[model samples]
Structures are given as structure tokens and as C-alpha cells.
Target: MSPWNWSDLHLRDPWWLTAWLVVGYLGLRALRRRPGAAVFYSEVSLLRLLPRTAAQRVGRLLPWLRVLALALVVLALSRPRAGQEEFRIRRQGIAILMCLDRSGSMETPMSLGDTQMTRLDAVRHAFRLFVTGGGPLGGRPDDLLGLVTFTGYAEARCPLTLDHHALLELLDGVQVARRPPGLGGPLRPASPSGLTAGGGGELPEASIPSDPYWAEERLTAIGDAIVAAVDRLKDAPAKSRVIILFSDGEQTAGVVTPAEAAQAAKNLGIRIYTIGIEPNQATLREIAEITGGRAFTAADPQALQDVYREIDQLEKNPTEGRLYTQYRELYGYALWPAVGLIVLELVLSSTRFRTLP
Candidate 1:
């Protein structure tokens, strides 16, 4: 909203509006001035009895027509214009990629101030609020957002997109890694004859869990996740490209180290904001500093949401939103009408409204 937007009539030359006083004074004089008598007679009682013709009725309005023309001319001189409308031309927004850890540690029970849930669930909730807007947080409607999840390996869950609904839907499906029962924990193998290895005794039964997909889900790969996010954001067509890395553990499995990935992002003019969930902050802080971003530690779900809010404040739209007003010149409208009225006054005064001096 701007000052000029307050009114629809924009006067380019407001000083000309003062001419209205002169026009009014001249109109008053014209109204008060009497025309000289065209003819004089000894007796004039017959003239009062004569019927008033249409020309005579029109003739009385001639002075008023002159005054109206002068008013229109004054309006034209003021250079009145119509404020068409106010609008804003918004520029492109920032591009952000969020990398989240899905390792077994993320499944630890956590409280979100009001309710208790897994750490992964709390992260999802906070992310939803950050994207869709909630109490104290404005949504990232103008930004292009993407997601990456990592454990032993990194996976690109979604590409950069403006459709937040789809992005959130994908985020809802991310879950903590569940290890297979027979694979990870302690295991006791019985002999082929159903006897203990040490002696001829009944072999203790072993409870073997039945899932194989947990191996990759049990280890954290912070560096690999950052590299994957950098790949997604390096070519993004935004002035400001950012990567938000969230992890509960240090880099446990990845070909490239976190520092190397951070250096790569810095080379491409990208920032990486690291958020640690009850983990050592030294590596996270180093990564953030390398990429010219910040590091945050979330002790609880509320603190995690607060970290996201702070990031939201830090990354505003790259382009500023500005309001502009466009005005359509209206002086032509007044000027033409003024000219027509003047011509009409001239014709009428020279003919039907004419009086002898």
C-alpha cells in the first residue's frame, strides 16, 4: 500500500485547481450582469402577456453553459488522472532442500511439549508447520522446496517443487529404520542334531526377527545426504539456494566427508544450515560455517520447531515485493468536453442567446 493508492483521482498539476475560484467569480458576475435592452417602447404591457418561446428558454441557460465550460477547462488544466490500480510484481523466491536422518536413533521417543511421539514424527510435524504456516511461522509459499532422507545411504525423496501439498504428503511417509530381528542383535546357533554345541542338551531357542531392509536404515550418512541435496540445489534457478540438514548422529556412513560436501556447496554459492537433534554439534557447526550458514541444536520437539522458525526468518524471499500505481490520464476526457461546451456556448450566444449591446 502506498500513499497515492489512497485516492482514485490523481492530480498531476493540483495548482490549476485554484482556477476554480476565478471561474466562480466570473460566473457570479455573468449571472448578476444584465444585458442591455434590445428595443425600447413607450408601453410594455403587451410584452409581459406574450408566451415564452423555446429559444427564449434556452437563451437563459447560456450563462450557465459558459460557467460549466470554464469549470471543465479548469479540471483539464489540473491534469486529473485515474489511478487504475495498485499492484506488486514479485520476484522469484529462494530454493531450499531439506535433508533428514531416518536412522534407528531417530526412532527414539520424544515429547513435542503437548504430546509424545518418535523423534522422526516430531520432525515431520515441525516441518509441516514450517511449510504450511502455523502459529508464529509464515509458510514458505514463494520458495521451491525439496526433501532428502538418509541412513546408510542417501535418497532423494522429492525434487524441488512449488506444490507444497505433494511435498508434505511425501514427507508423511518417512519412517525410522526398523532393524531385522535375526540380523543385528546377539544370536545363538544350535547344532544340526538339536543339541547344544558344548554338550548334549536342548539348544536354547533363538528369537530371530524377520526383516532384511533395516541394514541400510540403521546407519547415519550426513555427508552423503548433504551431497545429494547439493546435487538437487546446485542447478536451481534461484538467487539464494539453501540446504537444511537435520541429523541425530554424526556421519557414520558416506563416501564423502561432511566437510568436503560443505566445501562443494560453498563453491557453488549455496548455504547449508545444520540442525542437530541431541547429538554432538562440532561437526554440524563446522559444516554450517564452511557454507556460510548456521548450526542449531534441538533438545526437544519445541526447540526443533523454534530452529525451523529461526531459519524461516533468516531466509526471506530473495526479491523484495514492491507496490506500484499506474494512472490513466483523464485530462483528455475533461479537455474534450470543455472544448465542446465552449463551442456550444459560442454558437448559442451568437444566435438564439444573442442580445443587442
Candidate 2:
């Protein structure tokens, strides 16, 4: 906020200003026209020959002091307040579910802006910008944001919540779904060591790599992700329910098809925004059209941000405001000066400046 200029001060009762002018006129008139008592004498010039007393000289000016005090009293009656104009916002936020793909393909890097980042990295980074704010999508603090991640199957990572900071913490921990064989992660065992512990006592090298993985986790399940997101949002408190799905691969797993999921979302009045990275746009577009939503294709990170920017605009909820204006009472400003001026008048009127009969 900038400093308040003179224009920012508004008189709440401007009609009182007419009273101010009236009082000023009356006070000035009394000061100028009030006459002193004088005795008419044939030799009045001889009276002037007498030296003027200190009290008489000072006493003559005290009427003007009273007039000045009255003028100040008039000013204080007209309340002056500091006024500000702005949108006083109290957001009734939308409920949104972020459907993210963490399949192995996301590990592949793509060029974006001046840096090269993995698809998953780009998506996560862009989304963090969207959530915490500082990008095209200002932020979603008002919105309850949830997260759903998919690989071979979909999992709800977070429930719909207005606590975006906690959501971002969860987002930071997300990694590509499956670490391929020979690479060690939660799913796969560490690289096979030459030593073995089975045969009675002495260890022997393993003949075959332990089963590549317990389950195939690299496959994409687009339909399952969408369904999961919709399920979470179906009972959300807000009327503006939305699902934003970010994926790099087409459906390779899950019992439901993307088309069927889109129809279910449509029936529930949930809008789904689909972002596909270097994939068949036809499927995404079809899903979007069915759900009364839009499909965006992001070739690079910059393109991805633009797509989200567009979604930010489309998904915006009508913001309602409850205005809050803080007013510093300028009455004190006038009141103090008025008080000081009146004190001065009282002091002078009682001192050497005192009037005498």
C-alpha cells in the first residue's frame, strides 16, 4: 500500500462542512465587528495621550484567539477519515485433485526454458509453482488440493485439503513409479553381490538375478487415475470440483477405460483437465470433450506451464469479497490541534492578557 495522499482523506459528513463555513463566517464577523465601550468626551484626543498598559495591548488580541478556537471546533466536528479503495476478497475456494503419472517413462528428460529436466521433474516443478504461487496460476490457497499418483495402479496420495504446504511436501517426495532391474529402490532389491548365504555355511554367487520385480510397475493406468481423482472429488464440499491429470503415456493397465471414466466424471459434474506429454492427443482430446473440459498438449516444460496457465483461467471460481477498510481517525489530528489552540487562548486570557473592566 502506498502512503495516503491528501485526496485519500474524505470527510464522512461533507454536509457538516457547510456548518464549518457558517461558523467561520460568524466567528470572523464577530472578531472584526465587536466594538469596545468608549466614553464620548469633548477632549477625547487627551485620552489617547495616556500610555497604553501591557494588559490592554495584549487584551485587544484575545477576541481573535477566541475566534480561532471556535473555527477549530467547527473543523473537528467534520469527521475526516483516511479512505482506501480495493477488492476486499474472502475466497470461497474450489476443490481440486491433481492426478499425476509417476510411471517409468517420466524419468526421460525434456528441454524446457533454459534447462533440461525430466518429464516428472518438469511437471512437479510446474505444479509446485502453481500451488505455492509465483507463476501464471497465482495459487490455490483457497482451494482444497488433493493428489493422486498412478503407475500400474492408482493411489490417493493426499486427501482434499486447504493445507497446500503439506501437499507440496508430499509432492516433493514423489518419484518415478518403478526403478528398473539392476537399479535399487523401494520395489527392487539392491544390485546382486557376488557373495551368497544359502549353502550350509560358505556363501556362493547367485546363478540368476532375483526375480526382476514382484510386480510390473512401469505401466500407465490413465483410467484408474481419473477414476480415483473423481471418486475423491465426488463428495467434496465445494461445487466447483475439478481433476487435473498429467500423464506421458496412454493407458496400459487398469480395468476401466479412459472413455468410461470420462463419462462417469461427466455424470458427477466433475471437470477433468488432461495434459499429455508427447503422446497421442486424440485420446486426451476425446476424454476432454466427453467431460466438458479441455485437453492440452505440452511438448516442453514451457508449454506445460502455458497449459496450466490456461487451466488456471478456466477453473477460476467467482471470488466474493467482504470489504475491510481500516480508518485512522483524523478527528484526533484536528482534535489535538484544536485542544492546543484552546489551551493557548485560555492561558493568555488568564495571564497578563486578562481583560479588565
Q: Write the per-residue lDDT of candidate 1 for residues 236-286, one digit (tens) a residue.
A: 989999999988777666788999999999999999999997556788999
Q: Which stretches in model 1 have alpha-carbon errors above 4 Å?
A: 1-80, 84-92, 180-213, 279-281, 318-323, 326-357
**Candidate lDDT (C-alpha), each:** 0.83, 0.78
- lDDT of each residue in 221-320, candidate 2, tens digit only: 7888889999999999997998898887777677788999999999999988899976575778878899999889998988888887888889886778
In Å, residue 54's CA in model 1 sits off its true spot by 3.1
Global local distance difference test of model 1: 0.83
With candidate 1 superimposed using the best TM-score fit, by how many Å does residue 327's alpha carbon deviate from the native?
3.5
RMSD of each: 8.7, 8.7
- Which candidate wins on lDDT? 1
Cand. 2 Cα-lDDT: 0.78
